[model samples]
Target: MYKARAWLSRSFTALSSNPLRVCVVGSGPAGFYTAEKTLKAHQEAQVDIIDRLPTPFGLVRSGVAPDHPETKIVINQFSRVVQHERCSFFGNVTLGSSVSLSELRQLYHVVVLAYGAESDRALGIPGEDLIGVHSAREFVWWYNGHPDGKNLSPDLKSTDTAVILGQGNVALDVARILLRPTEELATTDIASYAWTALEGSSIRKVYLVGRRGPVQAACTAKELREILGIKNLYVHIREDDLIKSPTDEEEMKNSRIQRRVYELLSKAAASASSQPMLGQRELHFVFFRKPDSFLESNERSGHVSGVHFEKTALKGGGPGKQYAVGTGEFEDLDCGMVLKSIGYKSVPVNGLPFDNHKGIVPNIRGRVLKNISGDSSQVENGLYVCGWLKRGPTGIIATNLYCAEETVASISEDLEQGVLASSSGLPKPGREGLLQLLDNRNVRPVPFSAWEKIDSEEKRLGSLRNKPKEKLTTYEDLLKVAT
Candidate 1:
């Protein structure tokens, strides 16, 4: 035990003498988890997490539904990480605009791109650019008070029926938010602007359209059940859509979650009454409907009035592998609002090799590769990726924890092998140098302390309204609060 303690003491001394400087782009779960793991493993490692927003906790603050405050509890854990002695946070610093990848590479010994997928996948059909057609990403952000999403004035006032394309958890979230009582959301951290707008919403029915069958839905059973539990919200499912294929029995035998989801869906459909409750809302699950194009409104030339869908049939495949084949038959459903919740895709950052098709940085495990071929021999030394930027957008928040561990392990291995030894002589300026560069550019970064002030102010304001917290939606307001 004495010898072991002595070795640890020696290790600490060595680490103190030569610390590893890491700059993680994107102050999200992946970035914080990576920093936490890296700092714990390397005693003398210093980390700076950067984000484009004035506030931290990227998706946790903006992507998660305000109604689900329990999920945002992860922010408390992230708060602890940013407050670590070896860690710092630099918010309101745009990656490509304020500081380029080349600049970050020159400033830190190791640069990890944990920036999440910010762009949503397009439906690539006609009339997608019409008014009243929104992406689930921007809609969620707008409701959650993301700076970029503040201007997204979705026309909820013009529509009594809304249609959301895609059957993922995000679609379910949109459905729930539309159908949930405005009074219930009053105590949550939902953006005041969104709350005010939603309070005046005329929406009464929401259609969740999926190209595939019920067994092949991307949403988890928990989210589906939550949508089903909303008071005065009646769920509708076509009986024919629930009919199983020949392979469904075999597939259901292999996965318990799938079985449970099927069971819940079936039970909900069986219990649904033909007539909705008085002043109640309706949620319709329309399966095997592939969106072909959006229909234009007669009253408003540029606004969407309905969606044209091509009927689809299930083809032979395994449980999760089922494919949708389009039939010639077409159907139209009238609605003023259409939100596409297909999925999210990462955008290409300057100086980073992005796989255009895959919508992710080209990398082998965590090491950023120079080409799309993924040849490890052609790796860009000292550059790495994690989270949705490394892998395509998928998985839950906990998924990033393991993803960060793997990336940090790779970084540690490279450091031990002296792959980054050449960085010792480089003009790696660390935080001071980076801050100086930002100063020169007149970029005011919101430090962790300032963010704490904003957080406190938000909570204080929320208390006045009996809500969890009120977010500052505008950039100017956030900066004002932080300053």
Candidate 2:
């Protein structure tokens, strides 16, 4: 009943006239941005944004660190997009499960796949499967209250040291959570269960290990600055490690952001060396150390004891072209917990042509291809891709704005060039048909108003705890609250 009136706001029987029906799979930044752009570009277009979970704002709700609330302000803009008369939001409707990609194409004129990376790149080393090892993605999801990671139950109680492999913003976020005072985190919207676990954690030192030098650090300066400023956290940056090589110096000269980050690292190292605050909670920045393997603990069977790392140095290739090559020297750093933050990779939907090697859908300028050859002639009719699914997992949240623009532009260009001309020249049933298909399957989709109920309930509970909003970390709780 809601879907019938979703697009045909004035009439219940049929659409106005030849409306361009668009279905966006994924309610994250990319999906929402695609919907917004579509609606703006085509006045006669109707857009539906859907996700697998019962709530919208995919990564903004589940991926962003709780401490970095500022980064999630984009949700307000997206809220306005779904509030548009020609747009709607549907949750609890999965593309590959509840409805197939073929089903979506038949119901709508165009279908855009924007579902983001659901898995991380594997470390592919021995002992990585040890009990204490986890991907930084899982750890972030666990702490952020993502339902999939609600029961991660990392072993924070067993050891005083935690080793994080990678130097990205995510690595710093994980490091900050492990080292930041729980009292400060309590004021944020961190999951109550996670807060309880971290409040009792024995982890006092976290190693933010990177394969390359500081100049090539993947983390932005803003993230790096925040980690260095955490109160009572003594940051360890080796003075000798800060000495940039020729390639590193060239990189810094070309990039202002890199220069600023290295300067921050240098300042932190100088301050720590001069002040020498020993025995305090520490956050170590270990560069030029590439993890070779995880060492099994003799004390605790099937658990990790430490990480075996090979020393690495930069191989010159001019500015950003440099890469790390391992040297003969090796070292071991003991730690009870390990989180590898290498990167995230997108999982392919059932009917999509995904390039397994690149971990993205095979697309050219946002047009989905029939295969991985990437030829313009192979563009799949009425199918498109955007965000991390179109490109590899990289860039910040704002990056999606530009990426979505390219996809939407392609859609517009196709419409104008008659590339999407209907063979029958007839309007699609769109949401009206989709609702019937879903009803037959007995799959109920949560609407935007229903999501508002969950949002309100979360905020109410959070107010009780003096937090921003306490997340419901289980599907049962979220669905119940929505109901």
Candidate 3:
């Protein structure tokens, strides 16, 4: 009894003397929420957030639509978190390239992988490789000035029509950007090059296609209303498509949002039938269309001309569980460009166990599991996951708050249980050691203050153009400004 008490006292003393060190990969909403909660939970815990880009605020800066700057107010909150003395931000430091997973494990007591979905799910249909076919992610990145997509230079002047194969918020975002006047977009923080391309675009009509009915739409009512509210834009919808099935009626009975969305679509369809097609631009909400393949343009050899779709209908399951099945009816719609916005997917990091089928790191309550079964006893010590990587790519920005709380709670529990204690009773190297290793590798990490320099430069450029800010679209420009 005396020996056991002595050991417990020693462990307590060691934990009190050695403050916990945490490393968070990615700087998006999930990463920031995790850091915020971690700092609040453990007063002595220090967090270091690293991102691949020189700029912070992952998807908030690059994935969100520019016209909705209100959604980006969270950046201010994240900025305050990084400004805390115990927390730090390091940008332009990639996980796989600049440093490895093993190196991060050696430096911190806990590692939280919050890097968001970096790629989009492919349609896997033929002709997807055509020049004019692009993922909604690529288009979003291009307009937002992400380095990987700034140089896309999609041919917007060749065609008068665009078809986006999804009925999600992102598809609506793409449709709005293509249909909305460039003069209005100029007031936001859209890339200057994208604005220039849009100013000369010949596109006047956009189609938002969905395989399922209106009740099964992946978009929220708010997004649907916003698109329907655009002035001088005609809406086209088949009134029959708005007719809900018995299962769909049950879904609407349970979901107020779905009922609201159905009403908005019905109202638009009614209005569209009464009004003449006299608007400068048009928006079409197409349902029950499943993409079959992309057709090659007759005029432009390697570019897409249109898409062929198989008509689909709801089958099996009830309310919120129905699936789309083909009905053997196929239709073709001619369009200049096609943007596939099915969903975003996360790639695996080295030394991490990934579930390819689900496109997420297998975990239970944010603790990464060694196998696919997600058994609680098989959790990898000191390793955790949060955000879209922990769960699949779903949820709004605020959803990450609860997701992060669960992760931080697990971390707190482990700390209390001494599951995270080092056998040597010594502290990990943390940030100071990370700096030395980075210096040795000749990789320069962009500090938060350096990012402020880039921010100032972007704002200065924006002032010249009388807008919010003109983002630097290339790594060369971003790094040059940061330095």
Q: In candidate 1, what are the lDDT values of residues 202-249, reduced to their tens digit?
A: 999999999988777878999999999998887899988899887876
Against the correct fold, how does model 3 do in TM-score? 0.96
- Model 3 steric clash pairs: none
Instruction: Report the Cα lDDT for candidate 2.
Output: 0.88
lDDT tens readout by residue for model 2, 60-109: 99889999889889999999999999999989999888999999999888
Per-residue lDDT tens digits for candidate 3, residues 390-450, read: 9999999998888888888777667767788542466898999898999999999999999
- The per-model lDDT (C-alpha) reads 0.88, 0.88, 0.89
Off by over 4 Å in 3: 1-17, 273-276, 422-424
- Poorest lDDT segment (10 consecutive residues) of candidate 2: 4-13
TM per candidate: 0.96, 0.95, 0.96
Cα error, residue 405 of model 3, in Å, equals 0.4
The per-residue C-alpha lDDT of model 1 at residue 408 equals 78
Q: Which segments of candidate 1 are over 4 A away from where they belong?
A: 1-15, 422-427
Which candidate wins on lDDT? 3
| lDDT score for candidate 1 against the true structure | 0.88
Give me the displacement of residue 76 in model 3, in angstroms: 0.6
